[model samples]
Target: MKLTVRSSTISEGEWDQFILAESPWAFFQSFAWGETQLLEKVAVARWEFLLDDRKIAQAQTILVKAKRGTFLHVRHGPVVNRELVNDNLLWRQILEFLAAEAKKENAWFCRIGPLLANTQETQRLFANLGVRPAPIHAMDAEYTWVLRLNEAEETILANMRKTTRYLIRQAEKQGVVVKASHQIEDFLRLYNQTAKRQRFVPHRGIEAEFAVFSKRGQAELLVASHSGQQLAAAVILYFGKQAIYHHGASIVSKISASYLLQWHAIKEAKKRGLEWYNFWGIAPEDKLEHPWQGITLFKKGFGGELRSFVHAHDLPVSPLYPVSATIEAVRKRLKHY
Candidate 1:
């Protein structure tokens, strides 16, 4: 079969529709995500792959330039048609195409975090292509906690940890109220405070992200307050059939307000006709010392199945890649990942 690839200037609606309808669809692969990256001064490219002129796969890659070197990051992609993904030849062609594109962009390496399950077979597939595990995650979450929203709210509550359930009830008894709004000012105030307390760098593109997603009517800010004081907040992104708990922050409070906030967000997601609620990112059980450990425990308390994606893989395209890799490796170690 003849393989061909080409860049598309217009939005590939057919491609997105097909991919988003598939299982494991992620917001990063959506057309709007590329636009959001553009607002952050990052370059994005959309490509379509064909086998005998039949569309087989598509991907949107974000080119990120750092002080050390540039790299292409493909998060939760390239969304391949189910039938083509298993075809060895198709995978080869896709990687070859990505490498060529990376070379053209002067990227030191290309990183791919496909939405495939983390299994031995999946690891071998990428390993066979000479891809190595990346030092750090390209997206915030490599493993996520996802809840199916088909069950009744009571059933959902019953499935949660007793502590989580009690906390939610306690928050209510303590007069905690969760409010959903489009305003970012209030959320940012709490977000900044959370960052300060947690000692992590806040994402610099949150404003641009909110602006883009809100314009599409696909985002909401949920804040938990008690006695007229904000205690916790989150920016939830509604994409396809899933509601993503994208960015969140909370201050130290004794009111259990965060629990109420999460429960409220889940209910809001169901109200919007969403079928899934993704509590994005959690540390693996073995990585007890990982920076996300505390929050992961908090997320797990709500009761959801753990979905582990294949770790990010790197395809080195330049000699400078090792330097960047070393820096990333050191950073990961220092962060206790």
Candidate 2:
């Protein structure tokens, strides 16, 4: 097999073509993510592995520069077109290419947080490649909750947990209404308040989020109100056959009626013909002490199957500067940033 690698700067058409033709993981590997990485100033690197003049594999890696050093991260990528991802020759070429790129940039190490479904066999593969699993990054975890769109709305409602369906009905009975809007003020108000309460920095200010929504056809704001008073709000993202619950918040008045608001968002997404609803992240099932106890319980009540990804893993790119990688990881962990 002949192999050659190059930095990828493909057109969006070519990129999405690859995404539509490949598995779910391929979407993340598309150039769209690389563009986002550049916009976010995350120092993105892309590589394509070709064989006998045919494009066979691609990967998109992102790096964040910190006081310690540059910390590399690959989001849900290295999308290979092969039937099985375990082929040694292909893996070897990709791994060598990544290490070389890291070295060229003087990066500390490359961390890969794949959205691929997790398994013991996959873990062993990473181990074979000299990568070690790091502690999980719960907030960045990618989750997809699937709601069947083929069934009648009533059947879909019937499949939901009793209390969930009850909440939707109650919201209707109580006259809580949901609206989709592009108004930045209202959405930001709810988003900022929720972030403060939840103890995480909001990813984007409302204006910035609106700009993102305008460019990417994937996101929207859903606000639920009672008598014109905002009670619950959600920020949803549509991407590659999935509707993701990217962010959401609620006032005390809407707590009881909030489940219905989410249900409505799911229905709206389905009506728009999206394939899946991503609840985003859930605490591990085994970790009873998870901080996400409340939210996880609520998401599970929606009746989506439990799915987990391989915990983030990293490979040493510059063996001479291992301390840089350690310090970078520590700073991110300590800051809760």
- Global lDDT of each model? 0.85, 0.70
Task: Give the TM-score (vs. native) of candidate 1.
Answer: 0.96
TM-score of 2: 0.87
Residues forming the 10-long window of minimal summed lDDT in candidate 1: 9-18
- Model 1 C-alpha lDDT per residue in residues 261-332, reported as the tens digit of each score: 999999999899988999998887888788888898899888888888788888999999999999998988
Off by over 4 Å in 1: 10-15, 137-139
What is the TM-score of each predicted model, taking all chains together? 0.96, 0.87
**Candidate 2 residue lDDT tens string, 191-252:** 77777887767774445544555577767888888888897888786667777786778766
List where candidate 2 sits over 4 angstroms from the true fold: 25-30, 142-144, 204-210, 254-257, 319-337
Q: What is the lDDT of candidate 2?
A: 0.70
- Candidate 1: global Cα-lDDT? 0.85
Worst 10 residues of 2 by lDDT: 135-144
Highest lDDT model number: 1
